[model samples]
Target: MDALTRRSFICGGAALAAMATMPAVAATGVKTLKNGKTTVDLVANKVLAQVGGVLELTIKKYGKVAVVRTSKGVKGFSVINLACPHAFVTVKRSGNGWVCSPPGHGSEFLLNGKLKVPPATTDLKAIKFTANSKLLTID
Candidate 1:
């Protein structure tokens, strides 16, 4: 057998390590909600605080959704479907927005779920929600 190059060995090790961690990471921090309209009281939940606050919810009807309060004292918020429209890959937060989980796919989206990079042609789906007096009703 041929000798293994250092680069190949390192790359293989890294890939294995990432694969080992994926399942746990994928299973954690995802909340499952029944299919239907859902109400979230920010104050009562205490999960979403202020501007830049991001709350991840897994709606049975919509898969994964990220609720972000984007503005302070302005009641500006956005709900973005975290599932990649192209391949349904779970998107995760990266800097001011979100990116496809693998990162190598180069799919990125803005805070409003607009497509910002390639490999994904369509924008992420937006979930409708109303925020009033810290109460958010999502449909």
Candidate 2:
């Protein structure tokens, strides 16, 4: 696997591990649709920012993929998770895109999850986006 994939694997493992301690219901599988799409409100989801936009959503038991911009007009959007690859920190948007917490400064990322500097080289996991008149799919 490439360095970026390795990072994702490691971090993804950590995320799974963290979820292990939660209640079974928290980890229980939901209506995970392969061809279904749902809209997530960043503000309601508690992943919003002043300038940054959310890219995807995970229904815990469901699978995951990176969120991408579908169109180029008013409906255009981008999706991303808030987890940090370095130390599993719950990152946030510092200025425009992303910034890690715990007082260890200088860790920033582009809105798309590219490393802005050191300590984090892997970009955020992006999901697939498929849209049409009948449906908008995220898988």
Residue lDDT tens for model 2, 16-135: 555455332121112345545554432333222322334444545333333434334324545556677675666654444565644333356776677886677787555554444323
Off by over 4 Å in 1: 1-35, 73-75
How many clashing residue pairs, candidate 2? 7
Model 1 lDDT on a 0 to 1 scale: 0.69
Off by over 4 Å in 2: 1-58, 61-76, 103-106, 133-135
Indicate the residue-level lDDT of 29 in model 1: 30
lDDT (CA) per prediction = 0.69, 0.48
- Cα error of candidate 2 at position 60, Å: 1.5
Clashes (backbone N, CA, C under 3 Å), per candidate, total 0, 7
